[model samples]
Target chain A: MTNIKDIAKMAGVSVTTVSRVINNQPYVSAEKKEAVKRAIEECNYRQNINAVHLNKGKTFLIGVAIPFSNHPYFGLLVEGIANAAVNNNYKLVLFQTNYEESREIEALMMLKHKQIDALIICSRICGWDIIDEYVSYGPIVLCEDARGRRVSSTFIDHYKSFSIALEYLHNKGHHKIGYCIGRKTGTNSKQRELAYRDFCMKLNQPLKPNYIFYDCFNFEDGERVVKRLISMSNPPSALLISSDQVAAGISTCCKEHNILIPNKLALMGFDNQPIAKIMNITTLEIPLVEVGRNLFLQAIENNDSSHQEISVKLIERLTV
Target chain B: MTNIKDIAKMAGVSVTTVSRVINNQPYVSAEKKEAVKRAIEECNYRQNINAVHLNKGKTFLIGVAIPFSNHPYFGLLVEGIANAAVNNNYKLVLFQTNYEESREIEALMMLKHKQIDALIICSRICGWDIIDEYVSYGPIVLCEDARGRRVSSTFIDHYKSFSIALEYLHNKGHHKIGYCIGRKTGTNSKQRELAYRDFCMKLNQPLKPNYIFYDCFNFEDGERVVKRLISMSNPPSALLISSDQVAAGISTCCKEHNILIPNKLALMGFDNQPIAKIMNITTLEIPLVEVGRNLFLQAIENNDSSHQEISVKLIERLTV
Candidate 1:
């Protein structure tokens, strides 16, 4: 119940003097400091840890701004982050923005208020203008896309990964390759879409606009995409998907329809999630734990001057 | 940027009087209230909405204390709570304690500080004495068990559910039945263990000590349990597991070993999550969304009463 005001009154000094003494800052005489310390000890005053930490410009909390926490990709990312956080003696306070502008802004405001030491955005939903504005407040790190932004970043290259999946299918004598991606709004999806477009243009392959399906990046979304693709006028022999969950959906649907994988319809996916292994869907295994570890390191260092973008590698499986 | 103190100083009034005017509380002079309001308007002071909401003794933030958020069962529970919270115009703040006593105490302290309006404990890790101390601060609703000393709870009857699963297997002519439970420290697991004991005693069947396996309610844990059971001299023909995630692990392990379900080993699990449906694991469907709704209703009512318990029902599947 004891506050700085109580310590100041007992020490016969102003609240500022008491604050200086507690923070170990300069300008307080030894006598006054001793009196303040004695008064604090007498009252057993417990200084607010978060408040004091803020005043000293060192909030121990790290803010993670993400869209959702339930999906296997994001879930694994969070698990990696959480594991590293526990090891590094740090705590995470999540901000589930659900891709809303207002909620994303709230996470940025925490930096200005000195509530969070730094921020790690897994996937940005807002435009770069807003992201640029918040970058001045504190250290801001991006997880997925760099977007050629000035802020520090750590992510896998979606363009190259998507190209590799498609190129592999094309080389296997499967020229008619379709694709499924996450929401078109995200930077990662945009990159993947660009990769898909450029690859089709170069190969002189017919680019069917309806071949691309964009929605949530989950198993159910993948399943829906597969349904749409299967019912298409000219369904491709091979499919390139954004995430493993989506691949699972397509695989499950294929099993139900008796469309055998690799033989009937080949598939390649991204994010070699556990289910991808169980279902034997060839995928690009982006090091999720490493991504989380690097993000935490960047956040704790509190430096945005240097940015790092990790590369993605393909994990071969039976689906292809 | 402006706070109550700034308005009070400009209006030549105490901060309490300014708060009284802002909150529209009685016992403030008309002239002073008018002056405070005028100063607030002149300074363009916008109250911190979150702080003002806190001042009204209703933050609309429900703290959900769970062991893990990545698991399917807990994830579904979170989804249920989040859906209910959206309906009620509330937000959920997840506090992943990993069943640590210190973390539970921190959640209780958040309630004391009026940070979170109420608490929905999906898993109990706090002692009864500590829970008793927290009940005075705000509503604390239990979701996993009903054996609270004074707290109101919405929980499935683990004992009855376990007994039914065992009895169903017994009726199918399986005398040697195995059991896989969660950590024994939890009330739900304790009840299930007691039920197992009672069923064995009543049937006058020899209880195979090696048939029981205990682990965390996770996929890997279930697989590990099955591995140990199959290695035993005589493994039970039917196994009763505590969670769907664990059953998935066991199912995966069985598939790897080419062991047929229902024919080689009958498996019955708890918490009929979506994954259970996909894997065809027979389980008791604990109505999670209903539990969330009931707990939210209990929290809003703020009734101080003894614990409440909910019932569970078995859902037959191909695994049985």
Candidate 2:
């Protein structure tokens, strides 16, 4: 509750002298500094950290923008980022954007205003132009490929990962393949869409718009996919799910419906989450924690621009 | 990068005049105010938010300390807190304590230094003595029963909830009952321990210390429990698991090992998470999000210390 002014009044010195003493600036007399120190100790005064940050031009706070905080994927990412932050002597300001552009803009504005030293966006809802406008303000790190952009990123080659999964399904004698994703927008999803189109064209099969499922993020969304699948006259024999939570959900629903996995409907999941191993669902493992760590490191690094690519591996399990 | 001094120089005014004009304080001449405004616009200066907070003696940031960011229990609680914070125009400074006392001390220190306006500890590692030391710094809200303490809290009556579950199992004709917990130290866990001890005494059963499980948090921990159960000469017929993730793990392991549920072993889980519902495990529904919302509200409320007790419900399903 004690401010510098209180300390100044108590020490019988000007407020500027108290400020100089607190900041260790070389203007205050030794006697005046000792008096200010005694006054501070007597009152148990704790210097406001904001004032310290104002003098240093660094807040020691990083802004992390994620759509949802409770999702398994983002949870892992945040855990890694938080761990790295702790080691670097920084704290995180979480911006749960919920995939809203306005909320994402709020995070960007915080960077522009110098509230946070840097920002790491796990997934962005804003377009490239909007994100580019804030690049000169501070470091903006992305979890997607921004190799040619002004910002830095730690990304996964979603196109290659999707192609590998589709090819594996194709080799397993499954030409009728479909996929589910969190949303149809975003760079990652668009890359996966391109891979699926190329796979269909290479196999001389017409693309089925109905085969792609959108808005699948959690286990509950799996129920919606199942309902749509059963109602279709020609459902894909195998499906690639973007999240293990969703894949696990579909697997559970299949069991309840007496639909045998890998025989009735093959499933391949992404993220290789713990549920995937427990449910025995084959998945492409993306090391989200490692990606999150790299994102944080890049955010703090004073480099021009950097890009790091993380590779995914396929884990063989019973569901495929 | 243009500071107040630069603006003052450009406006041909003193720094105090520039500060007064920027803060909208009265007594500045109309011509001088217009000159300061034009200078500010010309430079496109952004007022540092930290300076604004320093002047107001308030930061629109609340601190949240959780043991882990990736756990389901804390995840749900954080989601609730985050939603409430977004609605109230506040951001969260996350301190992933990982149950370390030093980490918790850092969070308390932030409060003392006036970095965060208030702190909401979802779970605590420090003792009451240490927490009491920071009570006068700001509003410190807990997620445990802190009725007689100086801080406000929104907590569950762990003793009553544990008793209800034990009574339900007793009525179902179970004698040998064991329980699992994340740890044995916290107030909540101690209450559960008391309830278990009293249950055994009331039923004329011997207290089996070996029956109590410790360090069980995630789904993978179920494998360890099952391994220990199979190795025991006389294992418990029914078990009370504190987390649904662990319960689901035990169920999955049980199916693999050909153990029948409710026949060989009956299980009751807490926190009725999504995994509990998906796996059809009987659980106690603790509205964690609602509890989190209340905790946030209490953290922001400038009232005397208040305590809110959230009740739990029994959700009957197949696993029990």
Candidate 3:
């Protein structure tokens, strides 16, 4: 093996000069650079690319911080990001936080250490203040509608999408309409809550506390919600679910219980996932793939700090 | 501000000596090692950990190469790998190849370049010759049953499991049995086809070429298979689906076409994924999470080029 020592000795320069030349550091004379290059060529040394990348202050690697990897929504986003990374000649290092603070911090630390050129945060438990601290390190692109936080972001207007779902349900002669949520405190959920409340107030429909199901993320959660809803003294006529997966669950459980959809209980889901089309569940189509592509673009540009909004549209299916 | 150059100058030693000291390389004289240490301490130098890792020939990073990121089987496997990585203080660098040879080469290159300590190839398109060439670079762990190639592997006994599935379907009085495949030439699929053929030949049952569906990896593909199957002059009374998601699609499509599961068509799916449970499809449990953990364990061990076969169990559900 031709070590750095060999290169230095062969170049007939101080080890410091050889080190500087090898690392692509400035202040090395043209003569020393030529000598180092000649030595490397003569020795045919296979240098670790990480050494070059560390010196360049960029790795062409993007860090994607997401709470989950297997979830269809996040999976679609990751797939889109993967395509962009391939096209742009970058690699994505995933930080599957699972909503844990410690795991999320690992990604931010990688940014601080210059392990990655940029970061794309899909969702976060940490506050904006915590995220802002790493802004100077490199581009920090958010995959959320955080236009108010002053960073590059690509997201769908959850409030508007939720409003579309609620208003559609309300106009369908459903006075008592309830909804499902993943988390009460998440920005998307908060906006959805606001939209639900505003729609109820505008339509003069009384809001039922029990109708709001919390933490409904998957199909099983939707089934559990439906089981709970049926036992209630008075259940809503229609339900606006947080995600299509949840709606799929409710649909399956409903079939088992012989609860005819739309005829007995109207259901509307969000995200318009492929399953939604298969299940014929009317949904708000959140362009997550577009959000992912835009996030990568912003991170690569590392500038503009402009908020990018991906449009959401309502798809009509038999469930509503 | 204190780079390797300053450390070399301060230590009164070659930059290579300072690098060897920082990288914890052996064979340095006591005097030089002590001098480099004292100089580093005096300067309060904070070396780039990446530089140190590069020199040490270790990065504590494992490259995970999978065809899809969001698919349930791969997602579960990745989640398992992520947990193992976190526990072992290693990071997973994902290469979502999507069945592309070019993308898969990137991970192998990273392994050769010492960017990653090892590679955990979940699935790959590259031939064994290409994969075997990189054996000296680092430990290569496969998610498939490729024991014949002389590498560490964590995989299911697909042949045995498929035989079990076929025999079980036979005992259930299904003579006209068909199956779907992701790729015609995949090891798992080949085993499954062998089982299907061996079972048919032994039982003196006729094999219908039209029943063998190709490229049935996803939900849409499965739905396409079902649509094509029902239109055939003679369709199989039962189907052994390639994956649970595909089975879910068939189940959903069956519901639309006013077909009764188990009675009209017996469906058996693989992977026993969460969607399988929701759809109530009978499946062979591959224990993907267990496979992932075992792969990581073998990768970290970096020895014992033994073939590991994870057992598969048949789970009875309403669909079958």
Candidate 4:
């Protein structure tokens, strides 16, 4: 088989010119391109390194394993990831696992097979011990703040975020507060719950079991949680919600019942999403997009294992 | 260099077994797999066909070009496409273009370079003429209904959808209807405009310039649009919103002004997004996920050139 140099020689062009033509670069003249094509045919040349493949040792592809995309948290995170990816001339491969363990493993397998240069687990289902094994193949970054020295991660300190929200509510003279949670055992949810419990304990406020709502992420969950609160003989004066969407849901139900927010049932939500701004709902603003961008950047740039903690702020508005 | 056959012969295993070991298939015995790796190392073999790469002539990767993933429409479409891609053992490369033409062309370039097997343009920035050139490289599918036979497309007929929406509004005794639009020059927005104009003309109702709200897509846009309508001396009795997101925005603004939905101002929205369902806003349900699934299936399964049109339905709820 003839090599590219032999073809270049036969075509009366430089090796770089032949290489440019093969890579589909635009500078070569049509006449020179024709000559190169003819030489390639005459010599029966086959370049094993095709333009189809990305540059050697750099696939320039990133895999993101998120439980779902339509949700507010993941969507905001992806928005940041996608922008950073396009700027860096990379593409995002999303694995919508619906929080299933097997679905999450598919992205890990892709990393093992070198299908993607790195993996970003947005909402991890499995522990770091299992994920640390794939670090040898490529960078494996977790979105949650994990205590893994061998792995890289970017996360909002959910504990501090919850504390900010809880402190804000307590400052407003709301001694009794109920909070909504997404998952019963999710790392972020657990952190938020711990913060709530600790805050109540320090204040000498009763931490009632009925005040804690679990598995609350969406609008309906928030609505149902609020309705359950409303039916209680002694409902908490204020509510710390998990997400803006759920808060919005609570607001909707309140409207139907003629229950004025803050006065009747004060509410503070998480993830200061656009709707939070629109609805004027006070929330602990977790910069999810920034977390995603930083996670991807760290995976690509920081080969040395490191962890990044994104800070959160409390934005005051009408609902709270 | 030694090949798989030589390694197989040295290990006393069939070439199939050697290939299976290289590909990381599960059924191979641990002893046999170890022997093949040893034989491969001894011969100093370098196969062009590596496990890192997909099978020869097939990357099993599809590129999807969308303006943004954070939006409800694109998010739903991606969910469908991602599900299909995972089921087919393929991966999705998202090109979040933010509707930029240059960004869209990047996905096309990936197709040209054989990085992805096909390209799915969810919302096109460029026309078919430019995209037709890349059809020879691989399949290019459009998310919107296009007048291109060479390329396969799966889309909700915007014209038909608007017609259905308009007729329903008209039947409900809405003579003067205001409509919101995302882009003044977008294909879907334009199609919707034409439908509104045609419907009014056929019904002997005049199409008012003030009734058409341009550059509205998100919740904030809808709020601003409705505020503009309220200040007008002659506001339309009903509004046909471009998206459920915009409708949700409109709903938020309405609540702020103490305005009643359906009773004071009748409204219609497009894309029955989760928010829309939660808000109980009347909307035309565009099967965005189904469109995504059919688009991927068509690109992968269809060899012969054809077009598919996904239908939309109006889901009657509160605030129609």
Candidates 1 onward: DockQ, in order? 0.11, 0.31, 0.23, 0.29
For residue B93, model 1's alpha carbon misses the true position, in angstroms, by 3.9
Q: Where does candidate 1 clash, by residue pair?
A: none
In the range B1-320, model 1's lDDT, one tens digit per residue, is 45555677899997656756765668899999889989999998755554556457676667777777576677667666666665564556666777766566656656766767888788878777567766788888887665635666887888888888999999888889988877877888788888998998998876777788877477777668767767878888999988887888888889888888888888988878767876778998887766767776666665775466778888998987
Worst 10 residues of 4 chain A by lDDT: A46-55
Candidate 2 per-residue C-alpha lDDT over A32-145 given as tens digits, one digit per residue, 9 for 90 to 100: 999999999999776776666767788889999999878999999998899898778788999988896656776887898888999999998888857876889999999998
Give lDDT tens digits, candidate 3, residues B175-271. Answer: 8889987888867777788888888889887777888988887887767987897789888989998799889888888888887889989999999
Instruction: Please give, for residues A106-172, the per-residue lDDT of candidate 4 as tens digits.
Output: 5776787677888988888865545655678888888777755566888888888788778888889
Query: Where does the lowest 10-residue lDDT sum fall in candidate 3 chain B?
Result: B46-55
Model no. 3, DockQ: 0.23
TM-score of chain B of each: 0.81, 0.86, 0.84, 0.84
| Candidate No. with top DockQ | 2
Candidate 3 scores a chain A TM-score of 0.84
TM-score: the better of candidates 1 and 2: 2
Residue B225 C-alpha lDDT in model 3:
81
User: Distance (Å) between predicted and true CA of A145, model 2?
Assistant: 0.8
Tell me model 1's lDDT, rounded to 2 decimals.
Answer: 0.75
Segments in model 2 whose C-alpha atoms lie over 4 Å from true places: A1-48, B1-48
Tens digits of per-residue lDDT for model 2 on B238-301?
9999999999989999998998997999999999999888778999999999998999999999
- Enumerate residue pairs that collide in model 3: none
